[model samples]
Target: MTMKKKKTIFTAVVLAVLLAACVAVDLTLPSYHIAVTVIKKATVYALVAVSMNLLNGFTGLFSLGQAGFMLLGAYAYGVLTIPVAKRASVYQYFDGGAIQFSLPEIFAGFLGDTVGSTVGMLLALLVGGLLAALMAYLIGLPVLRLKSDYLAIATLGFAEILRAFFQWNALGPITNGSNLLKSYPTFAHATPYVILAGLMIAVILLLITSTYGRAFRAIRDDEVAAEAMGINLARHKRMAFIISSFFAGIGGGMMAMYMGTIAAAPFKSTLTYEILLIVVIGGIGSITGSVLASFLYIFSSEWLLRGLDSGKFLGINSPIFKNGFRMVVLSVIIMCIVLFFRKGIMGDKELPDLLDRRSRKRKKEAAGK
Candidate 1:
């Protein structure tokens, strides 16, 4: 077989094995297991970070509105998917709530509980994405015209404005008005999250390899030159913005499912900053890097450096190793990376490209020998 075919087969086998392992672990292990939660959170963030990368890394759009789009998705999914029977309890604060119905429950009535509910959840996720995309399209029209820091500030302001709007009491009927939206459907295992995130990333990879993706890259490199080359900057930029927001919305839906509760407070500028930082550290334009960095960030923050918060690490009792110290260490590490390795781990290169380079190198060395 050709080396290309061998690589394809190898990649497929690896992915299959990984998926099976995730399923086994999710089924066999306890729900509260650290590995399970970390993986789930990482998976969600990976999707969001990739979406951010699509805008900032590939399209040269300095958007900081991911948190806003995510909030919209979380609220949309949570509001639509809450069990009908439980709505009264969940919305007790807002005059017994505004929305009295549930989409998934309706689906269950017609399609049977098992299949219908799953399908309904998927549809709700799609609705959430569409809502986010719609918002992006509307917002992009005006905001996409801005350049660099101006665009970033505009998007950041929009996110804050969105957060405030969600918290407004007048909109309480739809958003629960700063109150927690709970009792929504949740994923029982990491398997579903893994599958969904992988699918989304695969779709993004396909988009990045398309003609439009090349246009986006050209814009990122030189907007003036790309325009001279007959590329429509406004159209492509808006397309990337809408597409990124769509995935961000889906990621937010997955996050809501993972958390089993939703609140507007968590989806803030800070969340956007975190995801953007992940993209920067992951090699801004590389999907594989974003994913790998997501796992690493989660593991380091949630697992490895957890002991630092409690002042116990390698049995060393240092006074400085108290609460918030973990973040300090993490921040320093990120700073070091930014200063020394600005291009990040993958440096805008995909994993397949790196593998191909290595294979070529090996062949040359073998021939020389």
Candidate 2:
């Protein structure tokens, strides 16, 4: 085999080993169920972080409303996936009685037991993503015209508008308004979510590594200069926005499936801010950093913050921290990270670079020997 091929094989083996080790370590956490749940949630957030980074990080767009897009995706996926039989019992908010659709026999065979439900769920998610991209394209026409704070407000307004629109009874047939959609699929195994997460990560990684992705970076660095250099700024900007929104929508659908319940209010500006927090803490344009940060942020909130807030520290009982303390602490941590470690943990660098460096060092050491 060629030297390059050998090195590639070795790298893949090493990465697989590392991944297994990490999973093993995660399994050893104090609460296995909680650990699994946190991981599942993190996977969804990781997708969001990557999507947001694609625009905010590489493309230099300060667009918000990520949460809104996610909500849209979640609802889209939820409405389509609930089993026909259980629709009446589960979806008390709406009456989607007597639905019918047929899947190909091979796909049905491959999906096995959950074929019908899973396929519906997948279709919903796909549709949600497409819808989000459509919304982004439409929204971008007007919102992208603004820059900086104006753009932020416009995007924020768009999210609010979406929330309000979803909450309105006129669209209740589709959204169920404020009523929670029940009888939805849960992350019982979390395998589907994990798979979706993997696909999203792969797509983002592939796109960001492509020449088009570099163009996105150029537009982000200097829109006017990129345009002057013969790059289609508007086209690229719109593409980034649409693509980011697409994934954000998918992430939202994943969240809905994982949570099994969602409310429109919770998916507003507050969520947008939280995602931004994760993105910033993870590093603006770094996908690896975003993945790590998503895990850190979600796990910290679920495990660490919840424990602290519940006052369950070594059998102690006191509410000294009080409510909202978690947010306060999170805010402080974010401030510190931003102030002390401005380039984010990874900045523009990816995690694979570290592994590459280690591999080269080992090769150099062997040569010296």
Q: Estimate the lDDT of model 2.
A: 0.79
Candidate 2 accuracy as TM-score: 0.86
Where does model 2 exceed 4 Å of error?
A: 1-32, 90-112, 314-319, 356-369
Tens digit per residue, CA lDDT, model 1, 1-369? 886787777678777998898888898899889989988999999999999999999998999999999998899999999988888888887775888888889899999998888988998898999999999999999999999999999999988998999999999888888899999887778888999999999999899999999999999999999999999999999999999999999999998998888999899899999898888899989998899899899889999998899989988988889999998999898888888999998988776566687888999999999
Taken over the whole model, the C-alpha lDDT of each candidate is 0.91, 0.79
* Winning candidate number (lDDT): 1
Q: Provide the global lDDT of candidate 1 against the true structure.
A: 0.91
Which portions of model 1 miss their true places by more than 4 Å? none
**Ten contiguous residues minimizing lDDT sum, candidate 2:** 97-106
The best candidate in terms of TM-score: 1
Tens digit per residue, CA lDDT, model 2, 68-144:
79988988877766655666665455565333322222245566756754675677788889999999999999988
* 188 Cα displacement, candidate 2 (Å): 1.3
